[model samples]
Target: MTACVTVLIIGAGCRGKHYSCFAVHFPSRMKVVGVADPHTFARNNLQKIHNIDKKNVFNDWKAATERERFADAVVIATPDRLHKAPAIAFANKGYHILLEKPMAVTPEDCKEIASACKANNVMLAVCHVLRYYPASLKIKELLDAGAIGDICHIQHLEPIGFWHFAHSFVRGNWRNEAETTFSLLAKSCHDIDLINFWMGDKRCLKVSSFGSLSHFTNSHKPKGAASRCLDCSVEQTCPYSAKKIYLKLAEKVVNMEFEGGATAAFTMMAFTERLGTRKTTVYGTKGELFCDGSGPVEVFDFCTREKTVHPTNKSTVIPSQLMGHDGADYYLMDSFISAVAENKPSLIQTGPEATLQTHLLVFEAEKSRKENRVVFVETRKEHFP
Candidate 1:
């Protein structure tokens, strides 16, 4: 805890590598001491890059947990369904945890993981990386300073682009809810968490969500369309053709809706032609705040009838490998490692209790979608206790 925080990389997939890269980029603050993945290729690849010791390398997370705690923390980036067991196991082993998003597949599992961390007195930082963005922090600061004059309504959108949807949802590991989790949790938890974060203390009393696999179902499949885009006669015309999406042969179209608010909040997530863009607008009594996920925060003050812009403070020195999601990934990893090194859970914004609450909001939205009814969210003082 005094020096660099030693971290065990679990899963060693895309997310695992992204989080582990922080150690590579900032060796003095963090170090990758071990890695575990069922796939030998993945484990070995990360091992070679991090020079992980052979004695500490593991075939699976359970094996890593079998040994006494050697690292100060563990980054659990395993698939959605596999989160609970490994998280609880590692927490019991006394390793502070940096769990990937959608803390677990179910509310019960998320609660249990949070409880385990609390009981063991270990820090738990969920990967709600959006909150770590400079824009996000600035927006929060402005809101806290009454720049927006008390958020009355918020509208946030996640445009997962048609190709991105097809790639990650239609044919990827997240394609089946039974295999992983629902689309909302798989793709939009970060959006939901951000909305919840901007809402500040205004508890979400009720939520109603509606979404479906309407366009992706077999019923919507074009006639004579082959199972694979390569074999399809209409590959050139099919908007979702893998060739078109992966190769960027076509432009994107996005779905959008906007309504002006300080108390009410809405989140729209879609896999349309809109490439991975996010737009957020928070309406307050005195002013309005807007961000397009890549641009500066725009604020319009009603009192002065003037507008001001706050540009994002980009981190240029960090290598692209250590950055993603508008450079929030690097900051998120740095914050979590700082928290683990200092044994101060509060150092991270997405601590167990805060993440648990936002995740509950997501779960409720999903329930509302499934049941086709408005679901009331439960307010909690502390999720762990």
Candidate 2:
């Protein structure tokens, strides 16, 4: 019989909810022994949803770790800035870790987390959920099969449409470049990782990026505009109004539902009410992918004149779904559980080799930006054991 892995969840936000749901789906082998978050509402929601007892709830992860907690592993879903401490604490205590994306806000911090996990023999995995997408996996398989030959270059973009950017970045937690790194680091780290995954042995060489608050800045505000979206003068005329986009989509996206983060709904609505739009583009040698709204994965192959569309599991054809990144939420969790149970390497994200490669791109990209030159990615020979 597979030994059930007891798990501790930190951060009760959207990502936390996804992890909890994943635990529910894998009850035979994984258990949600406890959850931690500063927000009472979020903690209560997780407890009720996962049927966890009040004693298992914690506002501080340090305290949770102190009691020789029930968890065999810790999932760090806290804000980007708070990742390091909990990750180090849990890893030092010999608890395996599942971290949210970008690893840590800075490369130095990523190194620390990685080193601690390695020294403690704790498995560390990052939440780069895009890799779990079946379509994404297909792309990787095709590349390995030499369908596109050697990858020479890649140009990727995340078109966080006018309102979406405003909600998440401008008015939301990731707005200021100072608060989050560049829009690229904060958002495009996934693209960079995918680019590395697709490009194979090729290095980034250099990255010359140019972007700004553009449409969302105070300088771009229209005449008689108010700070809040609910009372904006453009509310009636603007198609980007918060109420129009978020409230409308909330009827569909589960995480946006009233119980989830209705605050995210209102916050998104407010940003859309203010900033007009935002977009990103990524180009690679083999093919291209694009996303405007928070929807499905769409792929277009220039060389073969082929196109594939993979709808997120949220559509009518697949109404009921998991949190995190659609089916990706389950794919990653399942991989983690299997890796732990079998005492084998994970095929999905995590693992030192994969984490090292992913973080190297971030490091090189920053170097390319600062040095005003293209930085070549160094090749590493280690394979997952």
Candidate 3:
């Protein structure tokens, strides 16, 4: 059956457009028929690109959803705090939802969103993109085939590049937990989701985490250095200079090193070691699997004493060849579309219940860190649609 999945993009931010991009390639499978964003310029730009009708564009998601109930799905990429209302409203209005991760920023809100999805009988796919990556799929396949045997423990690292952390968590949109959420939920929720994905039905029962903003606080400010990079005398020596990131990114665009405009801009942030990092390792009864966002997926078998690598040269950090976070974004949308087409509960592994469990674990990790004790997670009763 044809997809004909019409999407209402609730937020016109880069992340929203990233998934909305699916329509550009598989126009027949899905398309953004409407967009709801407060930014007129963003709505206008999307309209210009996808040719959505003026009547379908609105300054608010609530108003748009109220006015139109025919869209097949709604992609809620709104800010961390603004997710629940729109998601609940749309689900009640009979729209399947593709939501961003850290579901609703708080445990209560996460529960509410999951409850609403269940109550309304709508498919709620939290955008845990890592679960959809080809490398992740391969790892899952390996584990299922008993290449890694039964699980043991997992070691995961989110090397939030220094500048990346500063840009997003210190000086950027998610810097203040009061406004958004903690670094764990805002950035690493999906990361932990990937860990859960590999762990298979084995839940992360006990967790104790340790992390902090040790490097970006006001005390860390270099003496005599101005607040902004441009005004700082030691801007050149500053490891996390804004000038370096944008300039290099602009140059890549000029040189045509990146094909998609958004993908190129994404590379601008990712290619720099100015300080972003994510690496994960899964240990099982038989072997281990290692993978990082910037590089290859590696597998080691203790029984055979063998190891193998795929998709790149050795275990080194590899530049993204195309957009969608090494194609995870595209695969995520593709899976969602398949789910819609087949009217199945889900096409991929993680959904509302699983994603909610993952987000809660991050919360548990934070709690463990704060209280200085190990935390245990109870078995989650709710499952996803």
Candidate 4:
């Protein structure tokens, strides 16, 4: 094992806490040395978990990254729009970064973040966590060995479930593109990134897409329907009731929801409520690969006229404890910590630069949808102003 790596976490929200849970799981391998979050409860929990000094705990990332590099690396899990300043500062300050996806909200900010990381010689890894799933890893192995032969095209779907979409994209933090980012980048950058990764650096030439908030907007709201679920007369039959997830009292959350500054109760409840599905189909000359993230991956061989199924991407043992994302989340955090310890940027497949193209591909797809025209992906040199 490499030497233990210390990570300071910014933004103790949903994702920040999810990745930092690794520190709690493997004390000998890694630790959370400092945390900066405006939420007092979150900051307090991080301190308790890692025995962090009050001096090392702050309310803002500006304060966290203000001085001598306190830890070997930083985990910038701040929201999509707020990534640039902290990312640029910490990179220039010579701290390795594990930044969340949609590296920045705009083309200019994305380019600037990558340039800053490169110029400072800092390792800036993006949170394209889907690549770390054992199932995904197995798929990569199969493709590399010609299990699927030459690739033709790929089809992917992210069924942002009826209620899940209503809760998040329609009425929650990511309701519109202006505040957070396009739903494509904010939500499904992982799918786009993985498609690019599996294609082996062959640039996405062009893509066209079409989607809309067809069912979730005010236009679809039933007549006399109360805006708040609890107050609505048709709450039981509305199909989009908060009661389905939250249950009974709208304000009452799950037990131990925020105990010990950990969000186990909240995480479990939220994920359990999420009925979303992600599926990917990669077409190849010899065969085709199909996978439903909620289930197994199957390969169909045209020559042999047979099918092979992998329950967990051919993994010898599907880890049972990690319990979320098919254990990809745990593996991703572990690999990043290991890479930071060894000072090797190649410890994982996804990095800041590679993900930039994937992010751009999403932007192009969005353009295609809005303008109703095919958008060609520009080469790497052609990206940004």
Pick the lDDT winner. 1
Question: What is the TM-score (0 to 1) of candidate 4?
Answer: 0.88
Each model's TM-score? Answer: 0.93, 0.77, 0.86, 0.88
Question: Tens digits of per-residue lDDT for model 3 on 1-385?
Answer: 6658999998998888778878877778988899989998987888878999988988988788667486888899998899999988998898989998768877888888888888999998988887777676777777778777776656655555656665776678986888888777777666667666766666455666655556566788888889778888988887778877567530011000111111000111222453434565767778888877645678898988898886632223322321556566766787898887679875856677888877877777778767777666665763222
Range of the 10 consecutive residues with the lowest summed lDDT in candidate 2: 250-259
How are the candidates ranked when ordered by TM-score, highest leading?
1, 4, 3, 2
What is the lDDT for 232 in model 1? 97
lDDT, candidate 4, 68-159, per-residue tens: 89888899999899999999999988989999887988878888998888899888888888888766776777777788887766666555
Q: Over the stretch 43-157, how does candidate 1's per-residue lDDT look in tens digits?
A: 9999999998899998977888889899999999998998999999999999999999889988889999999998999899899998988888888888888997867777776
lDDT of 3 at 115: 85
How many residue pairs clash (N, CA or C atoms closer than 3 angstroms) in each of the candidate models, in the order given? 8, 21, 5, 0
Per-residue lDDT tens digits for candidate 2, residues 244-336, read 767874000001111111111001122223221212223345765544434445566778789766554432222134634545666777788
User: How do all the candidates rank in terms of lDDT, highest first?
Assistant: 1, 4, 3, 2
Q: After superposition, how far is residue 45 of candidate 4 from its true place, in Å?
A: 1.9
Top candidate, metric TM-score: 1
